[model samples]
Target: MSARPAVRIVVVDDQEVVRAGFAALLDTQPDFTVVGTAADGGEAVLRCREQHPDVVLMDVRMPTMDGIEATRRIRAGADADAAPRILMLTTFDLDEHVYDALVAGAGGFLIKDVTAERLFDAVRVVAAGEALLAPSVTRRLIGEFTRLRPRPPAPELAELTPRETDVLRLVAEGLSNAEIAARLVVGEETVKTHVSRVLRRLGLRDRVQAVVVAYESGLVVPRSDVR
Candidate 1:
């Protein structure tokens, strides 16, 4: 059988040291290839168009165009299924721009202090079209935003089975498949099935978008719900 292809990555950061460091470390991995690097969001967009990489590690802040705007433009130009996945990089887990990045189109984010292993894992996860919804960070940030923003109805949500809705709530709460299974007193595969159904029924591509829908639709709320 043919070996699986290496995941192509483009690292974008204003700092030369950071961009080079990520490229070097990721290149050392057998299944990862650093296809390119960029120092700002404009360059990020240009490189992404030029290389069509599997994933782009986008920095939240930059001089020419911010990551949020770049993410928006990239997503706008590509078919939803074909767009390259984006993993945002931020100095703080709660960086304000990150919330906007998620809304714009990032599949996940990494705090600047992330370990090499976690960073590599995040790239692989997003490249595989999985959502990197890190519980401690993602859920809390979503919750905070939910508390402040006005919830809009997501008409697609009305189509979910009650069980599917429950599963989505748990997912938005940042529970893993196993934890959700344990919480619902069902098998892990059952939880996975439910999660998958939720994604499909809602026309969502992955769990990250599901979480965004849960928040935007007010199906789940901060502090008072999902916990």
Candidate 2:
């Protein structure tokens, strides 16, 4: 058996010290490689195009090109298989726009003060092609936006099996695969298969988008009283 390849990473921040600290810390991990660093969003995209790393740690509020616009540009430009997973780093007060970052194609967002373990796990999770949606961040932020906007028609919601629909609702609720499997009295792999089917049927890029659909289609409501 062969060991998995190290997860290559690029850190993007306008603050030189912040970028260096992240790059230095991540480089110390055996399973991670800090391939490059950038001082702003524009430079980040250029580095990504050159390094083609597995994941990027992107700061949300940089000058010239904010992370949201950079994310939109990256997703727009990269070929499907070549797109690097992006994890947006944000301060708590800035999360109002973090939701926009997600919709713009960020794989996930992490609070800037997150523990080292959580940060590393977030990168690995996204690099594995799964969107990292925390219940605190993904659910609340998405639900808030969905509440402010009118529901969009998601005819594809009709395509999901009853079981798959149930799975997606649970996902939107921030349950992990194992937790969903336990709740539904099934195997974890079964839950994974159902999630994959839901993503395929809906043409979603990842779980984050699936969550967006669940909210926008009214599968889940922002307030507990509503649903």
Candidate 3:
């Protein structure tokens, strides 16, 4: 396919090599366009406001402004829907503070050593209005948050019907729409409707937040005995 309309992107990293590498890689893709680059979260926020890229490959740690704060500011700013989705970059082996990034309104994350295909795929996923709610990733994030933040109350429980609660449990277990449909013995479209209703009832941004709520609200606990 002739170069599709570019998914405008901004590379935000404190390190020159990282910034250049990301920008160059993304620019090489047919559908991706490198709109700008920034060396810190502060500049990233400013550039985002100015350029309004479709996606932002944000580094977790940077001088002047870290990815967490920049993401928060970008999410909180006027015209947040115009704000690009933030995909945090970090080493997979590192203790990446992913929970903070997600709560800060980042759409997802990518490890620095990821392959070009993986990077592009991640960008596409976030840009397509999907959250990176991988089961293992969500589990790790919930485990970390549970150890740090106080157990938040399930304030929305009263709003959720017993059926909604069941749907949420399946969501926290990482069941996709089809899987949920199959397990619930309902049509896929019906499951989708249920998912939408669940989100609206709980006032969640997306499935990722639903997973976090399931854990933090003590609705779902880490399994002491895995099957």
Candidate 4:
């Protein structure tokens, strides 16, 4: 069998040490390649355009431009099939701007203090087109953000079938495909199919946006107990 292509990556941060550190560590992985590094969001955008990397580890805060704007710009400029998956890096698990970053088109985020293994796993998951929504921190952040700023249910949600709607709710609750399958008494592949159809029908970019829509549209109410 042919070897799988290495996942091209760009590490972006305003801190010199942090940027270099992440790049060096990712380079240690045989399946990953650090194609470039950038000091700020502006530089990050340029590097992404130049390198056309598969994934970008983007710092949420920086001088000149923030990661949210960069993420939006990157998503806007690239075709859906070719756009790099952006993973925002933040100091706080519930960084105030994290919701904005997600809305701006980030696939997911990581706390800056993430372990090397967790970081590697997050990069691989995002590269494979999966959002990091199964993390408790992500669940809490989305739940809290939506609870604090509720919106009326989206009209687009009316398009989903009942089964697809069920999948979306479980997905918003931070359930993995296997977990959703077990809960719904279906095979994992069936759950994957439902989830994919939900994304396609809802016109969502990924699970993150689906979660946002679920909460904002009132399909999945945020629990006050989320923590």
Candidate 5:
């Protein structure tokens, strides 16, 4: 069998040491290739446009421009299939700007203190066209933000069928495809179909956006007891 192509990646941070450190660590993985590194969001954008990486590890805060704006700009006019998946890097798990990053099109945010293995897994997950929302920190981050600033349901949300709505709720609750299948007493493929339809109908990019819309639309309420 042919070898799977390496996942191209770009590491961006204002701190020189942190940028080099992440790039070096990611390079150690056979499946990951660090195509470029940048000191700020502006430079990050340039590198991404030039390298066409599959994933970008972007710092949340930086000079010239912040990661959120860079993420928005990167996704704004780019083709959906070609846009790089952005994983925001933050110092704290509950950074106030994290919600904004998600809204700006980041697949997810990673705390800078994450272990090497976790970092590798996160990059792989995002690269595979999946959102890294299974982590408890991510759940808490979304829940807290939604609780503090709840919005009315979007009109597009009404387009979802009852089954698709249920799937979205379960997804917002951080259930995996297998878990949602078991909960609904259906086959995994059925669950996947519902999830896909839900994304298409809602015009959402991925499960992370689905979770945000679920909370914002009141289809799923933020639980104070999210663990």
Candidate 6:
């Protein structure tokens, strides 16, 4: 019999209690393993080099080295074959640096008080190469980019066919793949395929980036009727 592959994780936080709590929760799960814990950004980089974790739950604020710089250094070390996705945890107000983290190739951000289930789900999603774009954060991410100068060229919106465009728009509206499939009268797998293609076409890293692009490019607007 073969051993199951574990999802290696590193928890980086200045708070000892938070790090211990997260590590405890993850360690309790059968498939999730805590590879290491770091109290600050410099230690996070050292831990990453040693553990090569699949995901790092990084806090936005830390002493000596903050999460953003740590994320940048980690991403700079990413290879074509392997890269550890950094899931940043922050308080929405003070952590304006999250916008830079997003543009710097950090996978996504989560409010620190998010539920344990959501945290586990985020780990799985990011490990699977998806972005952890929550509905609440999507709007904020869009707001961050409004009127920014010299942004990358409007991502190749034309690459998506009409049906794919429909899927992308729906995703930007905070619809899940299952919901999209139900609305479009298609199999869930079909919706998933369309979403994958849309992300690929636009060179988006994941759903979060796709949603950001959709809002920034005016593909989806917050209507009173929707959500």
lDDT of 6 at 102: 65
What is the RMSD of candidate 3? 2.9
Pick by TM-score: 2 or 6, better one: 2
TM-score of every model versus the real structure: 0.85, 0.88, 0.86, 0.93, 0.95, 0.78
List lDDT for all candidates, in order: 0.85, 0.85, 0.79, 0.89, 0.89, 0.79
Candidate 5 regions with alpha-carbon error over 4 angstroms: none
If both were scored by TM-score, which would come out higher, candidate 3 or candidate 6?
A: 3
For model 6, how does the per-residue alpha-carbon lDDT over 130-159 read when each residue is reduced to its tens digit? 666655554555554543522443659877
* Cα RMSD to the true fold for all candidates: 2.9, 2.6, 2.9, 1.6, 1.4, 3.5
Model 5 clashing residue pairs (backbone): none
Off by over 4 Å in 2: 77-82, 223-227
Cα lDDT tens digits for candidate 3, 30-99 = 8888999999999998998899888999998888989999988987754434668889887753354667
Error of 1 at 147 (Å): 1.2
Candidate 5 local Cα displacement, residue 145, angstroms:
1.1
Instruction: Name the better of 1 and 4 by TM-score.
Output: 4
lDDT of 1 by residue, 1-227 (tens): 99899999999999999999989999999999889999999999899899989999999999989999999887775765688899999998777688888878888899888999999888888888777886467777876776677567888888888889999998887777888999999999999899889978887666777887898788877664433
After TM-score superposition, the amount by which residue 125's alpha carbon in candidate 4 deviates from its true location, in angstroms, is 1.1
Off-target runs (Cα >4 Å) in candidate 1 are: 176-205, 224-227
Top TM-score prediction, candidate number: 5
lDDT of 2 by residue, 120-212 (tens): 888888888777875465677788878787577699999999999999999998788988999999999999999989989998767787888
Query: Which residue pairs does candidate 6 place in steric collision?
Result: none
Tens digits of lDDT, candidate 4, 128-159: 98788878788788778887888988887888
Worst 10 residues of 1 by lDDT: 218-227
The collision pairs in model 1 are none
